[model samples]
Each structure stands twice: as structure tokens, then as C-alpha cells.
Target: MVQVAGMNSMWSLILQGDAMTKCILIFLVGMSVLCWSIALYKLVLFSIKNKQLNQVVQELQSVQDFKNLFAVAKKHAKTLPGYFLSQSLRHFKELLLLKKSGKQEYAQGAGIDFLQMQMNQSIDEILHQEESHVSTLSLFAAVSPLLGLLGTVWGLVHSFLSISQKQSADIVTVAPGIAEALITTIAGLLIAIPALMLYSFVSSKVREIEFQLYILSDKMITIARKVIVEDLISVEFDENFMHDQLDRE
Candidate 1:
């Protein structure tokens, strides 16, 4: 009689353990699907953005007139790096006006000068715009692993309590909770790994764009100084604007 009772209890424990393993498998599959979907979407978006930006940079280097620059950028705004181009055009317009007024020094100056300071400020602003929404990827990557750890701890606690009540050290009594705990840990890695990869990819993309922006700013300053030195044009508003702005300094 005693042997039969022990065998029946073991069978019951085995059935419970099997059900818990199924639950863990289902949880892992669902979590993996969600993480992969997000990563794929971001990958497509970044790839398209980078390709279009290269084309826009090529067009920018070839343009000589402001009207032509604006026309090219506007036509490709939907697919190209329109935001940075738009910003550079606005700054160029300001510099052109300063050159017309013979205040070229105010429009293009040395690294430690006021005009150079303005260029740095513009670079910062453009970089900030490019980096928008990237922090979300970093946040998700950081939180997923911790969430997995939490689930692992919860499963272990439940398994120990079950073993105490059953008064036996059988795998049948403990396997379910242990499997569920491992499922959470695996789920967390599924969420974290790809997210970190995407974050690094996007970060590098932003840095490349920033380097281009800085180089373009320096080129604009050099071009303005050259035109002024050669007497190509005299700016009408140069006297009043330069004196007013510089006097405030």
C-alpha cells in the first residue's frame, strides 16, 4: 500500500512539471518575437537614412549658388538628409548677407573668435537633432536583463516552497519552477542583445553625420573669407549689423 501511494504522488508531480515547462517555452517564443520585430524595423530605417545622406552630401559639395542648393535639397527632402542641409543653407544665407556689407570678418573668423563660436553652436544643434529618439534603444537594452533576473528569482522561490511542502527531493517536484525561471532569463537576453547592437549602430551613424557637419561649417567660413578678400561683392548691411552685433560683445 505504501509503495503504491508513493508512485501515484510521483506521477502527479511529473504531470505538473510538464505543464510548467510548456508555459516557459511559450513565454520565451513570444518575447523573442517582440524583440526581433523592433530590431528589424530600426535596421531598415537607419539603412535608408544613411544611403540618402550620402547622396545629399555629394550634391551639397557640387553646388555653387544658394538657389541651386535649396532646390536640390527640397526635391529630395523626403529621402535625403534634409534637416542638416536646411540648417546649413540658413547659415550660408546669413554669411552671404554679411559679406555683401563688407563685414566679412564678422561672418568668418578664427577658431577663438565670435564667428567661430557661432559655428560651434550650430554644430551642437544639428547633432542634437540627428540623435533624437536614440536613447530609447539604450534604455530597453539596459532594462531587459534586469527584468529577466527578477523572473529567475521568483521561480526559484516558488520551487523551494513546493519542495518543502512535498517533503521529497525529486526532480519532478522542482523542475517546473526551475524551468520557468530559466525561461525568464532567456527571454531577457532575447530582448537585450539585439537592442544593444542597434544602439551601437545608430550611435556610429550619428557620429559620422556630425563629422560631416563640422567639416561643412569650416568650409563655409573659408569660402566667405575668400570672396570678401577678392572684392567679389560688397554687402549693404555689413556696417550696421557688424557694428551692432560686435558692439554688444
Candidate 2:
């Protein structure tokens, strides 16, 4: 009833606006749609990833050895933590092979440093993948308001021109221009506010994900150091034993 009539009147007012105003309205509508779409998609993605991360972290915490960690990571390979663990394990194996092949230069301090660098790179790549398209939301937030302001200025100029041409400042002559100006301004605010809010929310979530990744990376580094140290010690002991046997012969 009253709501329907109001809705019809609002549409009629928008229709009566100038071409520029109409175009601005259409652009704003499209931007609003895009903003909501990105927000919804990111929200769902972050929610799922966060859940997976928590589960993997819990499982990882219980792991006492690298073998068990690698196995647990294999089962959750689709998740961020799992991907990191898998990559770390791969590098670990490569380092072990180098050590066994008598590449002492690489198997000692240099090897651990190389593994740490690889793990850091892995974390960065995963973070980038998780944070894709978030910048678009920030861009929309900044641009929507400017576009709305452009529409508002255009409408005001038209209103003044109409008043001058008609030689009358009557309510009838002024109302349409004022309506057009306000509509575009309001539309812009609507688009900008939600976009800004969603951008903030998504950015915070990305930071949280990054923090978790850093924690996991630190834990992996600790494990890598321990494994490399033990391997080096075993190699040194084997070499000493062989030398003693050769001397006795």
C-alpha cells in the first residue's frame, strides 16, 4: 500500500533524472553488487580456511616427530598448514639427500638456512593466495564515494541551469534537480560504507591467517634444526668409525 506507492514514486524520480545521473546510479548499483559479492565470497573462504587451519594446528601440536607431522600434513594437503608442512618435508628430504651424498657444505649450517628461506617463501605464497582480490574491495571503497560526489555536483549544476532558464525559483522547478542530487549522493554513501567495512573485516582476517602461518613456520624451523643436527652428528660418527676400522686393518 503506502510502501508500494513510495517505491513507485522513488523509481519515477530516478527515471526523471538526467542521463548523467542515471549513468551514475547504474554504476553505483553495479559497484554495490560487486562489493557484496566479494564480501560474501571472502567471508565464506576465510571461514573455511580458518576452520581448517585450527584443525591442522591442533593435530600438529600433538606430533612429536617429523615423520608423524609429515603424515598428518599429507592428510590435510588442501589446507594452508598442510601445504606448508608438505613443502617443508620436501625440502627436508632434499637436504637429507645432499648430506648423504657428502655435500657437507650444504648439509651443515648452509642447509638449515636454505630450508628456512624455502619455508618463508612458502608462507608468503600461501598468504598471497589467501588474500587475492581483497584490494579490489578497498579500491571500490575509495572510488564509490567520488563517483557519487560527481553525480551530486552534476545534478546541482543541472538544477541551477534549469532555474535560470525558467526564470522561476518555484518548488516544482527545483524539486527534481534536488532529488537527483540527493539520490546520487545517498547511493554513493551506501556503496562506500559497506565496501569500507568489508575491506577492514577481510584485512583483519588475512592478518590473523598470516600470524598463524608465522607460528607454524617457526615450529617447522625448530624441527628442521633438530633433524639436521642429528643427521650431521650421525655422519660424523660413521666417518670416525670407518677411520678406526681402516687403521686396525
Candidate 3:
């Protein structure tokens, strides 16, 4: 009941603010709404993706063969790690086909470097795509307070002008202006604090996701290397059979 009264009083103060103060308050409210909406969206998205990534990581840990890894990758095809895994596997298959056809040597030398570069490029693209809209939160957090301060200053200036015009310094004349100034100031802080906090939290989550991507990249490279090494050994031991099998596929 007490809290309800306090909220009502705050709303009353907001309603009594002058035109410029009202505009500033409205803008602050809109910014707060957007900030919270984005924050909730990003938080939920990150949570779900993080869970998917952990699942992929667990599957990767138990995967003993390329076939099993490929299956795991396909299962989580919508996730970041799954996307990377699938792309890397596709590139590996292409390189293997080229090697078997005697058109490219992917198991060693410059071929391996090229494959690594392609996989890294794919990882970078996915990372960029996953990090969208993070900057908007930071922008709202940083700008809201300054806008609120502008409103407060505007209110104070108007208050001073009103006092000068009246040729008197009375509490009744000064109170409204002071109220407007305080309202704008409070409105600004209300928008800024949560925005700033969410921005920090979201940024840290993004960084953690990025770090997981790097780990995924390393794991993918390791798997690719192992597959290529085994394939190279098999081809060396039975070039004709391997070429025939690859050609038939």
C-alpha cells in the first residue's frame, strides 16, 4: 500500500512537469522499454544458444570417429558449434575428393593451410552474425543519462526565467520548476542504470560465447587434422582402393 502511494506520487510529479520535461520523460520511458526488451531477448537467446553449445561440446567429447562427429554436428545444425562443424566437415570432404582425384593435395603442405584458412573464415562469419544488436544496448546505456541531464538543465533555466519575470522568490513559484528538474533527473537515472547494467551483463555473455567459439574452432581443427591424417595413411596403404571408393561416391 505504501509502495503504491509512492508510485502514485511519482506519477503525479511526472504528469505536472512542463512540456520539455514531459517530452524528455517520454523519451526516457521509450528508451527504458527498448532497453529492457532487448535485454530480455538477448538474455534468452544467449541462454538457449549456450545450452545448445554445451550439448554439442558434450557430444564432441564422446565422439570417437568422424562419422559420429558428423552426426552430432547435423543434430545441432542450427547452433553455432554445429554450423561450424558442418561447414568444416563439408570443406574437408571437398578437399578429400580433390585429393583422391589427384587435383589437390589436402592432407599436407599448402592444402592444409588453405583448408584452415577457409574454416577460420567460416568461424569468423558465424561469430559476426551471432554478435548482432549488442551495440544498441551499449548506446542506450550511455546516452540516456546525458539526455536526462539536458532536460533537467532546461527545466532549471525555465524556472530561473520564471522567477525573474515575477520579480519574486517564493516557494510556490519555485516548487514546480524544481519538481520538473528533479523528475527529469530521476527519469534519466532510471533509464540509464538498468541499461548500463544490462549492457555489461550482455557484453560479458557475448565474450563468453566468443571464447566458446574459439574453443570450438580449436576442437574442429583438431578433428580435421585427425581425419586428414587417417585418410592420408589409408590412401597411402591402398591408393587404388581409396580412389575407387571415392570415385564411386
Q: Which stretches of candidate 3 lie above 4 Å from their native place?
A: 1-9, 103-106, 230-249
Residues 57-76, model 2: lDDT tens digits? 78778765566666676677
- What C-alpha lDDT, on a 0 to 100 scale, does residue 207 get in candidate 1? 77
TM-scores of all candidate predictions against the true structure: 0.67, 0.86, 0.84
* Model 3 lDDT at residue 117: 86
Task: Please report, in order, the local distance difference test score of every candidate based on alpha carbons.
Answer: 0.61, 0.79, 0.74
Clashing pairs in 3: none
lDDT of 1 by residue, 1-249 (tens): 999996675445434444444455455456556555655665576667767766766776766544455566466644435654444445555666666677766655532244456667867875676566676677768877776777677668878887898897788767766865666677678777887887898788777766666655665555445544444543233244333333331
Q: Per-residue lDDT for 62 in model 2?
A: 74
Question: Model 2: C-alpha RMSD to truth?
Answer: 9.1
RMSD of each: 9.1, 9.1, 5.9
Greater TM-score among 1 and 3 belongs to 3
